[model samples]
Target: MNKPVPPHAPLLEYYEAPAKRSDFVRNLFNRTAESYDGINAAFALGSGPWYRRRALRQAGLAPGARTLDVAIGTGLVAREAAAILGGTRDLVGLDLSEGMLAVARRQLGLTLVQARAEALPFADASFDFVSMGYALRHVADLSALFGEFRRVLRPGGRVLVLEIARPEGRLAHALLRGYMGAVVPALSRLSGRESATLMRYYWDTIEACVPPAEIIARLGEAGLAQVGCATELGMMRAYSARCPG
Candidate 1:
């Protein structure tokens, strides 16, 4: 039999208790870090790296730039950003889970910090790019997170937020939901309990997200310019914007 659903934490207080429901993610990733690439490939159908590449490319990094990957679960996006910047750039992977960072550190050999998205320890204007992959939906205020991203980015730098967007067309929406709610979880369950928990959490969170246009507006309010979005595979999207120079 399946486990009972845990009590829901208030959305506004998500950061206050990051581990209550999310510990599963951290512990799962930590234990399965070695097999993360394989797992993602199976679940994402080899499109995981493609999504990361698309998101990193949108950051438009100049050579030798510094970028921050917030909530960088296993440094997948950070590694791609490093490659996009030609390996001369600084890629900092930050997350609240030490277990996740442990895998990230070993896999990418990049700097990893255990920190929450709401309170990055870096100083103002510390990064040329700030990236978050599938992170915004779980947080409390999208606007607040954008504000933090803006604060850490240098003028002319950008924020790249890659997320599961609300599908555009009716047919596409139904198809994507079927994939996420049905196909993805069924495939993931074979990976075991941790995988099941992650799928459950992520599926629930993605379904609860605001539209891409709303996300663009929030980035604009956070002081980013040229805010834009690119959707792919119908459900996923990469939102990009620049700080005023």
Candidate 2:
């Protein structure tokens, strides 16, 4: 059997065992759900909305497309997608944390489901687009996640996955690490104690995440076609692929 494509190596500092990771992440997000959007806004410097919209549009999100926003924390990516689709009528949001889903329900009028990325509850060929934002590092297996993405997408459907990669330049890496590790967490204290911890854990995951090449390859291996990646500001990566007809 093939080994699982974990987004990051075991984060033993936060969870004692690999099997405990799902519970650890779910609980952490639940605790910080209320403050999640604010912390993201602070870290992204108010450019997240524009950036997400642009990425979605560039990846072929259009009006009338049925979209699924997996791991849709607080409706960040889903909101942008809804705008492009003209409304939330055609969009669905799914996440593992009910706390985050609560916040999303208040922010968006779409259907929300509490579910895991590896095991979507939807039927095959149900969506024209699939999106995941900033939560790739928290998944248990990229292969399983991508397979589900491919399964739920109709022919010619597009999948867009947004992630933050560690910068390749030494100076850039250090600067980003300093900002995310020290500065962001410090500012996040105003949100809550859990918010601060979440920010710190966020940076740790990015630093330890599997490389973009591995991610792209896994998407292709999952029977997706035209898999490619686009980067912005040297750190933000938008991975796009198409479901084969």
Candidate 3:
């Protein structure tokens, strides 16, 4: 069996055992759930919603497609998807955090399920498209997540994963590190210490995440074809692929 693709190396500062990762993440997100959207808007300079919608469109999300937004945090991506689908009737949002799901429930009229990305509760061939936004770095294993995405998708269904990647250019890397590492956390302090900690952890995960090539390869390994990645602003990546027909 191929080794699992962990999003990043474990941060010992947060938790001691790898098995404890889910608990740690759940607690952190629960603590920061209320302020998540505000912090994201401030960090993204208010471009998050527009960018998410455009990326979904670019990845071929269409009206009437049965879509599942995995790891859908606070409905940031799901809301945009609903707009494209003309309503929430064809959309479902799933996340591991109940607190995040609660916030998303209030914001979106779609079906919301509390679940992990690696183990979706739905039956096979349940969706035409699967999307995950920003929360790719939070999953325990990319292979399991992608496998579940493929299993839940009908033949020829598409998958789109949105993430923040470390830039290759020296200047771009430095600038992003400064803004995400220092500036965002500093601004998040207005919300609370947990929010600031979440932002800091967010940047750390981006910096430590596996490369895009690994992600693309793993998608292929998961039996998804036509895997490709589109980069925006040197830091944002939209990984797309399709289940074989």
Candidate 4:
């Protein structure tokens, strides 16, 4: 059985801790889908799309590789991947929110299916690359989700994940917290309720998330090899690992 969202941490537990965590997260994303990319762009200071593009390049994603992007909200990562692929037809996107997938469809015109990460519907050894961007915190069970990644990806397939991390060092950390906890939400007040709520949730999740070391260890446990990580400005994290041949 899939694990329930861990209750050990108050901040990470989630705001809508009702029903299954997956359902609540899905509903939240669906409700926020229309404004999702805009909110991301705001906090990313208009560099969200560019960051995704560069991060995908760093992840070594190449054109013509069969790719599956899990929890690909609004195709943020898929769009970058599509740019490298010359078209979107070769990439498949999976997400739990139809609302988000609808936006993704409009954005990229790629194949998309509504599905959870822990219980992927694809057959084993089906993909050359699998990526999940900015949605690891929303998953109820990291192990199950990564296991699904291992199962679906063909041998030698690579996995990439991009997420914002709590900054290291006292001053940078404090500044980031101020931006996420204060400035972002304050700015969101002008943006809309969806943006504000999403920004708050962003703070909570980033603050209470598992540390980068532990995430790397979990990736190892989930059967990925040669695991490695990179951080930008001590906040943006990029994780890469590969399925063993």
Candidate 5:
């Protein structure tokens, strides 16, 4: 049975799905492109960049490796990975959002491509590392996206996906819900940025998203090996998987 579509998926809520998701997400990020990094920092309690760096390190990024950062909004993860990999590696950013990529270009001058994760415009076995940062819930199909990750990865390549998971304990869950659902939006509004809607959507999507076990199963189904998750503070999760030769 197909999983019922989550209510707060920006794509399903604002537009018809599967076809309109790409456009809706692209436009949504475009609308918040300039302030994305700031919004992320605010929402994640100023640890967003640190989390990206830690995730890349945990994913075993090597020096001089070819990396493709999918949904590389404003180059958040890509920037951290590049800096960690000595800032001279061949790194590129891909996304459906021109506005976001434009900000990334201005920020880092990376090779940015406007494309969808479900249909990556790259050759097979092209990259040693593939990373997507905090955009998993926005995808139309996790299976298809993970399959693309495997297709574009060379043998022995790794994939890292960072996402915000709902907290486990009742107190933690309540705090997380209040923080993301109310505090972040209030902060966004106070800051005079139009990202309050996006913040609310993020919290709802994170809370309604599939569990980590299902994500790991999909990674295996996509032919990825050594699938695992490193969860932090009972809320943030980094999924690490590898392509077998």
Candidate 6:
């Protein structure tokens, strides 16, 4: 059953200046890409790898399915998808940062194009599955990006969006806020980074993010079907939906 589309809202409303936020994110990853994996493992309490694998598997991927991984930061999820797809056909990666792509190429040995999530460079219905991990919040327009995602997927193709969100229960949310607002930055600082401001920005962005139900609703409103969501580690969510055939 199809649901009504919610009122559209500006994606950058949470930030006073979207470009500055974008630059901060890009530069943060560029600077810390070398140690990102280690940092994430520590930060997520060693659950990062399991989360990544679970996200990829829940997308209903197969050995030879066409896959497009957007925001392929260091290609962690892409590499997993590639390994699952077994090098058969239709594997591509896209991102806005060349440095991230370089790191991804070195790590995953897959070619990735530099591109924006809202404006992908691909023909209509080009892929069987599209996946993104921890990147949707940076896009300035949710509707535009979802539209592009739907446009690029073939009939019955699925889109998987994995992102961090504030924990739902009041107590959990409070603890998450404190950890993200305080502990994360402190840890980043302890790691000897020049600036831990990026962690602060990350918390703000995730807190401002739309909830999982909203994401599934938006995907359906954008011409997708069979929308569903799965939450992991209480705060991370993977939403999936299929393009109507």
Which candidate ranks first by TM-score, i.e. highest? 2
Residue range 1-245, candidate 1, lDDT tens digits: 32322222343322345445355445545665555555575556334776688667756855678888898877777777877877723888888777777777777867788876877899999998888877676555576678889999999998788777657789977876777767776777677756655665566666666666677887888788999887777776778899999
Model 4 agreement with the true structure over 1-245: per-residue lDDT tens digits:
65543312544355545445667677778888888877776677333768877877777788878999999899888888898778886799999999999999898888899888889999999988888888888877778878899999899998998877787799988988898888988787676876687788878788888888878887898899989998877888889999999
Once fitted onto the true fold, the runs of candidate 1 whose alpha carbons sit more than 4 angstroms away are: 1-35
Candidate 2 residue pairs in clash (backbone atoms < 3 Å): none
Per-residue accuracy of model 6 over 1-245 as CA lDDT, tens digit each: 33322222333533456446556556766776665555555446323666676677777877767889999888778877877788625689998877778888787766678987878999998888999887877776667778889999989888888888778899988988888878877787765563356566667777777777777767887888888888766877788888898
Against the reference, the lDDT scores of all candidates come to: 0.72, 0.94, 0.91, 0.82, 0.83, 0.75
lDDT (Cα, tens digit) per residue for candidate 3, span 1-245: 86767989998787888889889999999999999988887677334778889989988899989999998889889989999999999999999999999999998888989988999999999999999988888999999999999999999898999888899999999998999999999999999999999999889988999998999999999999999999878878899999999
Worst 10 residues of 4 by lDDT: 4-13
Provide the global lDDT of candidate 4 against the true structure: 0.82
RMSD (CA, Å), candidate 2 to true, equals 1.0
User: After best superposition, candidate 3 residue 7: deviation in angstroms?
Assistant: 1.2
lDDT of 6: 0.75
Model 5 spans with C-alpha error above 4 angstroms: 1-13, 16-19, 191-193
Residue-by-residue lDDT tens digits, candidate 2, 1-245? 67888998998999999999999999999999988888887688334889999999999999999999999989999999988999999999999999999999999999999999999999999999999999999999999999999999999999999999999999999999999999999999998889999999999999999999999999999999999999877888999999999
Q: Against the true structure, whose lDDT is highest?
A: 2
Cα shift from native, residue 134, model 4 (Å): 0.8
CA deviation > 4 Å runs, candidate 3: 45-47
The residue-by-residue lDDT of candidate 5 on 1-245, one tens digit each, is 44533223444565676577667667878898887777777787434677778789889897878999999988878889998778734898899888888888888866888888889999999999999988999887887889899999999999999888888799999998999999998887754555887787778788888888888888998899999999878877889999998
Candidate 2 lDDT score at position 173: 96
lDDT for 93 (candidate 4): 97
lDDT of 3: 0.91
TM-scores of all predicted structures: 0.84, 0.98, 0.97, 0.92, 0.91, 0.86
